[model samples]
Target: MTDFTLLTVVVLTAIALVTAALLIARLAAPRTFNPQKGEPYECGVPTRGEAWFQFHAGYYLYAILFLIFDIETVFLFPWAAVVGRIGMQGLLSIVFFIVVLILGLAYAWRKGALEWK
Candidate 1:
């Protein structure tokens, strides 16, 4: 089978399995409802104030930087495995990629994105 057909079958099978599991759980699970369960916090701890609040931009910046470096490893592993066959060109390309990554990290560092406070 073609790749597209294989992907479609896999996706459909995943969806079907998830749906069947959910249906089975709903059918088999016991239901017990009480007045205490209707509260926002079922554990009985009272909320002090509004739960929603604006978060700092540094939090998002830090998380994005983390994800960028984290994804770099995903590319690195495959490149390392086939480095011998790819020769000088692949080595140079990865060097360039690493340089870019270093530059991005430096930029983020200078902008205080790495700072916790």
Candidate 2:
């Protein structure tokens, strides 16, 4: 076989071996199930009812806003790191990015997405 084919076979074999070993370990492990174990354990507090429940839409809206601002913060770090090397062009680009981000925040504010109630 060609070198590439041989390398591919070796990699596939390694993966298959690992998978078989994991399956064997799982099968050999003990199986124990009890009423307490199946029930939802909430920090030692007994569950009252079904775990599934409807949450407020406001919570989701706030989460989305938080995510947007969080992503903006993430972008800022990388831009700050390369600002000196990129010089004027990078500075201008970052300014534009900040402006756009601010505009989005303004829009959200105007739409009352920032309001708690």
Candidate 3:
């Protein structure tokens, strides 16, 4: 099968499996209807303010910056394992990758994305 076909099949199968599982669970689970069940936060403590609230943009910026570096760190693990086998080329490639990430981080820093407002 083609790569696209394989991917489509895999995705469809996952969806079907998940749907079937959820259906079965819903059917088999005990049914106890309670007013508090409808509330998302039913931890016995009543909510005081609005359910939805706005977060400062700084938090999102910090999370995005963290994920960028976190994914870069993940890429380093595989390269580290094969470091000896692929000598200078691998080393240079990883160095280049790191340079690109550093440049991106510098750009974000300069853009005030890292500011803890």
The number of the candidate with the highest lDDT is 2
How much does candidate 1 score in TM-score?
0.61
Worst 10 residues of 2 by lDDT: 38-47
The segments of candidate 1 whose C-alpha lies over 4 angstroms from its true place after superposition are 48-50, 66-86
- Write out the backbone clash pairs for model 1: none
Residue 42, model 3: Cα distance from true site in angstroms: 5.6
Alpha-carbon deviation at 24 in model 2, angstroms:
29
TM-scores, each model vs. reference: 0.61, 0.54, 0.56
lDDT of 1 by residue, 17-47 (tens): 9999999999999989987676678267865
For model 3, residues 32-93, the per-residue Cα lDDT tens digits are 98977766784777656776889888888888889989998789999999999999999999
TM-score of 3: 0.56
For candidate 2, write residues 4-116 as lDDT tens digits: 99999999999999999999988998878887787788987777889689978999998898898889889899889989999999999889999999999999999988888
Provide the lowest-lDDT 10-residue window in model 3.
42-51
lDDT of 1: 0.90
